[model samples]
Target chain A: QTVSPKPSRLGLCAACHGETGVAVMPGAPNLAGQRLDYLRAALKHYRDGSRDVPVMRAAIGPLSDAELDAVARWYSVQIPAAAKL
Target chain B: QTVSPKPSRLGLCAACHGETGVAVMPGAPNLAGQRLDYLRAALKHYRDGSRDVPVMRAAIGPLSDAELDAVARWYSVQIPAAAKL
Candidate 1:
């Protein structure tokens, strides 16, 4: 039996990171066009507390490995602000 | 009396944030071409502990207002990765 796909976590990311992964908040980083490996590693760092960002730690803590991968993949493909209008 | 200008703190920043302000580490954000106001605000937040990033807090804590502004100015003017080939 096939499992239903989980909902995209982009909205949660967008709350601080903006629709295109360009940050809406001052401290949040633009995730757009970042390397997929970097994104995945960052998420894992937050999840494991290796990176000390309170907001990111909270946001990434509950996500599964698949969810983290999915989020990283989504942001990696977006056009970075330098390329956008 | 004329005081000598302080050296650019870009070296400290470049330790994790590359020579051009793009991140060298997996979790560090690319600071190139970020908004000047936003960069200043982020530095202030880190200095004040309003943003809970240990490395940033340590890095920003000892800096004076002028130093923070200088660092912010330095990063805000660099070209972002999206603009580079």
Candidate 2:
């Protein structure tokens, strides 16, 4: 699995989720700095239909496991925005 | 905070995500059997605008931290459907 990818290599996920994994769309979740295992599991679920969101499933459809892992790793490593209460 | 709630008490999250946290909606995610820390952190981020998904922000808007914790607990304990590859 590719453990380190440059920000430019984030690819498909960046269309909805921003380059850094914060979402640009209203319904998409921010994935920046999320836990690696959660991102990995979620990506797998999206591919396999366990998560069952049409857009997500479609987005993840053609990706191989290594690609998914690289995408998850890219997002997990980005710095998440701070929470403001 | 209520650590143990019957499925009925999953409440708001269940409206889009099903009673067991498996999403029935096209855009919603399956929260069932997600990690507790991830769920808890996500709930807080939603409330704080860190996650910034409009539907989730609105859904979590009126809830307190303790209430969020309860919701996280509810979903985290649910049985996730197996990933079908």
Candidate 3:
């Protein structure tokens, strides 16, 4: 029996949501093309803490359900970034 | 003569992204709290047609230098999502 392939679940989240999430740190808010049901309901509201933070409830509270659906399907595929006036 | 204030730069942006910059639309990346520098550069790219998007060009093209600065600054104030894993 062998199993352990999904360890890199956006761990550090690209060091402040970049490399795909779109953010390059700073205030950090680019979740790269977010969609997939609103990034799985905001990662299930930070793993059910109701979105208050505390490192997003300790990084989504141990994540397991398929690694939080494979890191919200890899930032919901990434593409947005537009519509700013 | 009367002066109009900013005319709501966020505009349709809120239609897709949330009231702030987070995405509520499918495939739309949330911009809640991106860095000022990064957001500015990306917007410049779109305005110049280097990133490839008709809609972005249309939206960002007419913006003057000051407008650009304002929009970027707005998104630069949001907090970031935690490290996902």
Candidate 4:
């Protein structure tokens, strides 16, 4: 049997979150090189309503555990932003 | 004469976008290493209604040019994410 690449749970996130995860929209935060723990916790907050953005809450609430893990892992390993302008 | 440190136009972005521009929230893209032009255009789109998100439109529409420039400049210079996890 062949293995297929896991689909990104990012959904419409690419509209603002670029293919590499850099934010494409204003007010959207960068996600390239953030710490893993922080990323995970923030997602949990969104899902649990600790953070209250309608878009984020709806988007995060439906994600499965595996999808959440994939998002965290993908970002944790992303290329850090270049230090130079 | 004195100059004040330019405040980040990122506003509440710090809640999800870390101080360094790395994303602290899942599904949010990394903004640390993105191209300058892409960043600026996206903001414009948000403001011009090309991108239709209540959070983004509201945020981008209220910003002044200087504030927009500051945000672009800040992300343009953010440290890229590290290669290793």
Candidate 5:
């Protein structure tokens, strides 16, 4: 059996969330170094409509489950700038 | 004239946001080391109903301008664990 590769569109997330998940927009939340469980759950919530932020809903709505997990895992491991201190 | 002190109720923010703003719960976005402008704007949006997250609205709705600014400033300056790297 073959496994799928992670998505390469994470730059979409970086548009507002910053290249490192620190957020470039005023309202976007920082995602770098956050708990993997929370990041995944939040993405699922946005996708499922349980958490209804318009931008987030639209952004993650089209992603597959595996893609969501991959995105979450990507942000979870990013080294937050604050951690460097 | 005497000036009022910054609110001492930041512990309330820490309940879900973590004492250090890294978030202790799933779905709670980490706040540590985030941009000060973004943090303040997010809190204000929550308070003003523009960013309609129910829990965040309730959490920050009652704070005064100074209190809100204080909270945002506090979280802004916190050293995020990821930054230590």
Candidate 6:
């Protein structure tokens, strides 16, 4: 679990959400230190189109459940962006 | 800004998301210390039905813009559940 996420995983999300869980793109929410179950559920919903954000749906569409879980966990364990303030 | 939320505001969210932002309901996500902007966006979405969770939509249905912001801000400043763990 300590292993870094695969480049493919971070590569796609980092375009908007940043490499270390902070969101780099405007209006993108920081994923760092989010709740694991919550992130997991969100990812699943995005992938399945239940949540229906086109960018998020497309971004996670190709991923398997394991990949989603891994990415979600990675973001969940990172230090939150707000913790610095 | 430091004034506590009106009892009506907390009363609805507190049924599942606890008074201090932790979730008392099993499936409810912890809201404490979540990003302020993110929470604001989520509250708006829940109110408007774009995010489409029936329970959340109904719970926030009666709130005004100011009330939603007040509640979101209250949750955003509280300590995170994970931080306590």
Q: Report chain B TM per candidate.
A: 0.83, 0.82, 0.73, 0.76, 0.82, 0.84
Q: Could you give candidate 3's per-residue lDDT for residues B29-57 as a string of tens digits?
A: 56655556667876776776655557667
> For candidate 1, lDDT tens digit of each residue in B1-85?
1222333776788898886666788777776666677687778767777656889888876777887787777776666654334
Candidate 1 wrong stretches, greater than 4 Å: A1-7, A25-27, A35-38, A41-62, A82-85, B1-7, B25-27, B35-38, B41-62, B82-84
The full ranking of all candidates by DockQ, starting with the best, is: 6, 5, 4, 1, 3, 2
lDDT of 1 by residue, A1-82 (tens): 1222433876778898776667888766776666677688768767776656788888876778887787777776665654
Best by lDDT: 6
Per-residue lDDT of B1-85 in model 4, one digit per residue for the tens? 1223435667665556555556677655555555577678767766776544467677667779778877766766655643223
lDDT (tens digit, per residue) of candidate 3 on A1-85 = 1222433767666667765666565655566545567668766766766544567668767778677777667765644342111
Error of 6 at A22 (Å): 3.0
lDDT of 5 by residue, B1-85 (tens): 1223434778878898876677877677777777777787777667777666898888876777887788787776777764334
Docking class of 6: acceptable
Question: Model 1 lDDT vs. the true structure?
Answer: 0.70
Q: lDDT per residue, candidate 4, A14-84, as tens digits?
A: 46665456677765655555567767877776777655557877776778878887876665555554323
Clashing pairs in 6: none
> DockQ of all candidates, in order?
0.14, 0.06, 0.11, 0.15, 0.30, 0.35
In model 5 chain B, where is the ten-residue run with the lowest total lDDT? B1-10
Residue B22, candidate 1: Cα error in Å is: 2.1
After superposing the true interface residues, what Cα RMSD does each candidate give?
4.7, 13.2, 13.4, 8.5, 4.0, 3.1
Docking class of 5: acceptable
How high is each candidate's TM-score?
A: 0.61, 0.48, 0.50, 0.50, 0.72, 0.77
Candidate 4: which stretches are off by over 4 Å? A1-6, A82-85, B1-76, B81-85
For candidate 5, the per-residue lDDT at A9 reads 70
lDDT of each: 0.70, 0.65, 0.60, 0.61, 0.72, 0.73
lDDT of 3 at B36: 68
RMSD of 2: 11.8
lDDT of 6 by residue, B17-80 (tens): 8887667786677776666887888877777777889999988888888778888888877766
Residue pairs with clashing backbones, model 1 = none
